[model samples]
Target: MTSIAKQIERSYSATRASAKASRLVAYGIQPASRMVDALDTHSVHWRQWQMDVVETPLLEHFPEGQRDALVYLSADSDTTITQLEPGKIYIVGAIVDRNRHKGLCQRIATEHGIPTAKLPIGEHLHMLSRKVLTTNHGDGWR
Candidate 1:
């Protein structure tokens, strides 16, 4: 993942933690400034600078496995349905067989006593990024 993607992921995790703790930490990637005039900008933007000096280095210290463990690969319903595994992270991508209600991939994981976190891809794209590649193009172009 690119630095931006990693930052976005970590930002989401941090905000989620802050929310659960009932504290308004306001930690995340700040939106780009919209002001047109560069000279009009007042006050030094210390967050990015401070982050580069302090926070960026801390990210490198986290174990590789921990980072990978935090990543959840979202896939289409059919893809998820077949690839359900214990101790693995995943998110719902697209619903393949809505009529059969096969989209509930979490149920399969639960039955096996595996911890699974399911995020609705359409609604929670920011939180869960889909990375699964498929041979079948949804629109039948293939």
Candidate 2:
């Protein structure tokens, strides 16, 4: 998952982050203000997105009791996603850290009691490179 952390956000240049957010929006993904302030800053074509600016963090945006429905996708997670189940709000982090902060997302998810899962890439294909994927690539948008 590429969810934003101050460190991760700082790791990216503002323009690159904005461009990534734009791509997510292009793929119909709703971005949070904490990750990218494109809507508030009016830095991009805000009208092209089909979502309202989410001012709060995801955990607060949803009802407390619905926390179980939130799933954080982290490459470090032990669990692998075999299928896309309905009624689950899957969170894909938006940062590109280059592995400097390995297991950060999974740690965050564990601390918040949110379940975490890695993609089933290993089950389908073998690769010579690290398993980490870019936010857009992981989401099947690139």
Candidate 3:
């Protein structure tokens, strides 16, 4: 499960905070407004093998070069999700800026040369609104 507090948050606002909480609940996690640190190794999260994208002094979850990671489930991503790689870190960008910040994740991933993808939403649903989904919805949709 990839839910990085720092990588996804450009600025901390009440809207962002609420969206994060919703994502937490969607993942069956109780939302923590001020999660200072990542889950400990021996904590149940390690068993689940989680990682956060944002680099922070409080947490160093993923490795330096995330070659083993796959960032996906964006509204603007062109690549479609066809299969899941075993042991590959599949990270869904957590953004809730009300479309004011479009393609932010795509830009970041491209800057880092990280390949990005979106859920095969067209194949699954008739999009009435924007294709972007909250973190939890993306998590549960597949």
Alpha carbon RMSD to native, model 3: 10.3
- lDDT string for model 3 (39-127, tens) is 33113333232222233321134334655464644667788877766655555555452568888877766766667888776677777
Regions more than 4 Å wrong, model 1: 1-97, 120-142
Please report the candidate that would top lDDT against the real structure: 2
lDDT of 3: 0.48
Q: Mark the 10 consecutive residues where model 2 has the least summed lDDT.
A: 20-29
Alpha carbon lDDT of each predicted model: 0.33, 0.58, 0.48
User: In model 2, which residue pairs have backbone atoms overlapping below 3 Å?
Assistant: 1-73, 1-93, 2-93, 2-94, 3-93
Candidate numbers sorted by TM-score from highest down = 2, 3, 1
Local error of candidate 3 at 53, Å?
10
Q: What residue pairs are clashing in model 3?
A: 7-54
lDDT of 2 at 112: 79
**lDDT tens digits, residues 1-142, model 1?**
1322333334334434452321211222224422212212432342332122222221243334354432233343222333345544333222232336443544543443433443334442343334333222122222
- lDDT for model 2 comes to 0.58
The TM-score that candidate 3 achieves is 0.51
Q: Rank the candidates by lDDT, best first.
A: 2, 3, 1
Better of 1 and 2 by TM-score: 2
Q: Count the backbone clashes (under 3 Å) in each candidate.
A: 0, 5, 1
- The numbered model that scores best in TM-score is 2
Cα distance off (Å), candidate 1, residue 78: 19
